[model samples]
Target: MKNDFDWKPLALVPALAILVFPFINSGSTWLTLTVAGLAMGMIIFIIASGLTLVFGLMDVLNFGHGVFIALGAFVATSVLGAMGDWTGSDQLWRNMLAVLPAMFVAMLVAGAVGLAFERFIVRPVYGQHLKQILITMGGMIIGEEMIKVIWGPAQIPLPLPTAMRGSILIGEAAIEKYRVIAVVVGLLVFGLLAWTLGRTKIGLLIRAGVQDREMVESLGYRIRRLFVGVFVAGSALAGLGGVMWGLFQQNVIPQMGAQVNVLIFIVIIIGGLGSTGGALIGALLVGLMANYTGFLAPKAALFSNIALMVAILLWRPSGVDPVTSR
Candidate 1:
């Protein structure tokens, strides 16, 4: 295959384009676009991180993950709104402080929901792809309906604390304070996850289980407990992503999760199934492509993302999967 089709040259195209994008569009517009892309990518990464874990470890395609995110956003918004009314200040500090606990609560709630889902919905469908698909899709529908019923099918505005509402001046450009915070939080989460997975005994067990579940079980490891731990953790991460997105974007809606589901799948597909690093790289690529494309063609910015995905699929059907044989 290598002799028949050279893939290395094709791989360089995206890298080259990324290097050249700044030179082509050098201005405030470029900076704004870059920042927006980075922000969006961070959001995607947060959501995708949980997704990659589930897919990698459990081999489960969870359509209900989006619901966790939407729930987190709404939960944080409601809590902060209540705090604002109580304080009568509507200042940044109150809102920021309020959201910290709200996010934690949201994570806890999301984890419980995920645990129930695994117990009642997912346990029976293990090793059965068709059943898993049907059950998960049903879960998605039920989750969406629940969100609509509870939230009233309208978009809710999340109050951004005053501190997060402004932009910071960096050399010649200004970046949104909230976006910077989001990026920092996203990186922190990423780093922490990497450490947990790379430097811990549980992480080793999880990795070994992913490679050989039956063997792990035969070795006396409680696979069921591991699955539950991973599922709950993944849901919590999705919830955290939702909270960050709500705080940064200042809006929450019932369909927000549904709207981003397709793109989330695209990120996972491009990143490689089960690889967190690939998800991160793929998300950044997609984010930057969407932003830079706006400079070249404002109306068709999304087209660039689609085009990149198509090119990737055509060149490497296995995504960023590293295994190759000649």
Candidate 2:
């Protein structure tokens, strides 16, 4: 059981990367694009992980998750706007002081909204997925309007802090410092999730509830409460991802989250609905494929992930490692 987490699917990431390298030919260019892809994939994993737990444990299909992402990025704007001095500084430490607080505030606000969303929109159609999808989508539409009202419909520029503004050269390859940071953050998140879910009692209960909710309830543990907690945590992670994505793009718009929602869904489907490990693998593959395609054929960049998803689905329709099967 300890070794139940499969590592075989992860090989696709490196395999894909290696396969593309021969096409690119230039070592430095390949390295640069590969790192960029990995960075993007890690950011996606951060956002998708929460949904994985929510769906895996609660069977809740929340289409409004994008709202939380937009909220988090907007919240970061306010927090960072107030700390202009820190973000404007050349010192990395000062920038972190501003960013760390913004991240906290974004997570807090997103998590709070998640609670209300659970109470109102999601709670009613607990088992009706069709209603859940329709209502949650409506929730997203309204949330976008609300965001436009608060932040204005115009795209707000979210500049990188001075400390992370440029790239470092590594043997003719330029790697952005922020991208490396994203990779570290993603690894940390994955490690934390693996530890919490695989090594802790609470994690045990969560898994137990997922497998059989009634049994856990009969044992005096409240499954509803756990589900709520999962939703909040998932929302918080989406918020965290929002902040990262905003910084990555150096701009924020009300629809930014919705635009990303497509990719998130692709990752979920590719990863087999509720599997975290599968999500990571799928995300990395997507990121790599997008970059490779963009460089090799710019026109195909927009549909690269979609194409990858379809290919993956055709090969393994249930996903690379479907949680339902496990």
Candidate 3:
């Protein structure tokens, strides 16, 4: 009976509602929440994409992924600040161009960190779940403390370019340009990732590895290289996410990575650990839920994600596992 029903249309309902909700509740708060939710979901996608790949392909649970994000944000912020000082203007184009170098540097640093982690830390503990969890948690703590020490405890404001500081009128609703940029960037990244995974040789190898690591290894494939590659890619993605979040939130703090760690976990779990499509869908769902719930219960915004997590667990313990025949 379940096979007889179409799920594609059901999936579209959420997007449809997002478009129509503004008409129903055109309040500044609602509009803002909608935009914020969209922006947050995009950020989640950026981080979760790499995470899902690593977990799904390499079977590694990396708790320190949040650290990569925090590091990326800090590096980007520092670069932008320096650029602003040199250029003497916070113009949108200048800031945007400045972010390019920041992104590259952040990704390189994050990738190097991941490589070192895989070589020294994660290598010995491969397949040892308990040890992996313990070591990764310790790494997370170290990352958080390092940020506090280096950047201090205060929240550092990330300066947005003057042009991107305002909003645009969409019908009667005012939407922030930064939010628009976030959505556009998110879509482009997702699309590119989808294309690469679907069409590229390495992507095929990764998917094949996810299905059966032993089989791929037996075929003379260098599983270790693939694992390292996945880890580096994942870390780089997290770093990019941090940079984007810094721009969107306008603050960089030591504990910021810790704060978002749970949400990213929930997103991957809800979306299915190994599936990119699942991550994207889950992020959007969680994002919208958090935004809508915050409207009815501003104080309860913290619990919104938890509630969604519980619901997803109750409904599908395997998450959105695409291979599962439900």
- In the range 193-266, model 3's lDDT, one tens digit per residue, is 87777678887788778777899999999988998998999999988999888888888987778778888999
TM-score of each: 0.87, 0.96, 0.90
| C-alpha RMSD of candidate 1 | 4.9
Cα lDDT tens digits, model 2, 1-326, are 23256798898999999988889979999999999999999999999989877887878888899999899999999899999999999999999999999999999999999899899999999999999999999999998899999989999989989998899999999999999988988999889988887888888787677667888999999899999998999999999999998888888999988899988899989998778888899889888888899899999886888989999999999898786566
Model 3, runs deviating above 4 Å = 1-24, 27-32, 85-91, 321-326
For candidate 3, give the lDDT of residue 116.
82
CA lDDT, every prediction? 0.75, 0.89, 0.78
Flag regions of model 1 displaced more than 4 Å. 1-24, 85-95, 321-326
| Best candidate according to lDDT | 2
Assess the local accuracy of residue 312 in candidate 2 as a C-alpha lDDT between 0 and 100.
95
For model 1, residues 212-265, the per-residue Cα lDDT tens digits are 678889999998899899999988888888888777667888877776777788
How many backbone clashes does every candidate have? 2, 0, 0
Rank candidates, lDDT, best first. Answer: 2, 3, 1
Task: Evaluate residue 91 in candidate 3 and report its C-alpha lDDT on the 0 to 100 scale.
Answer: 74
Q: Which 10-residue span in candidate 1 carries the lowest summed lDDT?
A: 1-10
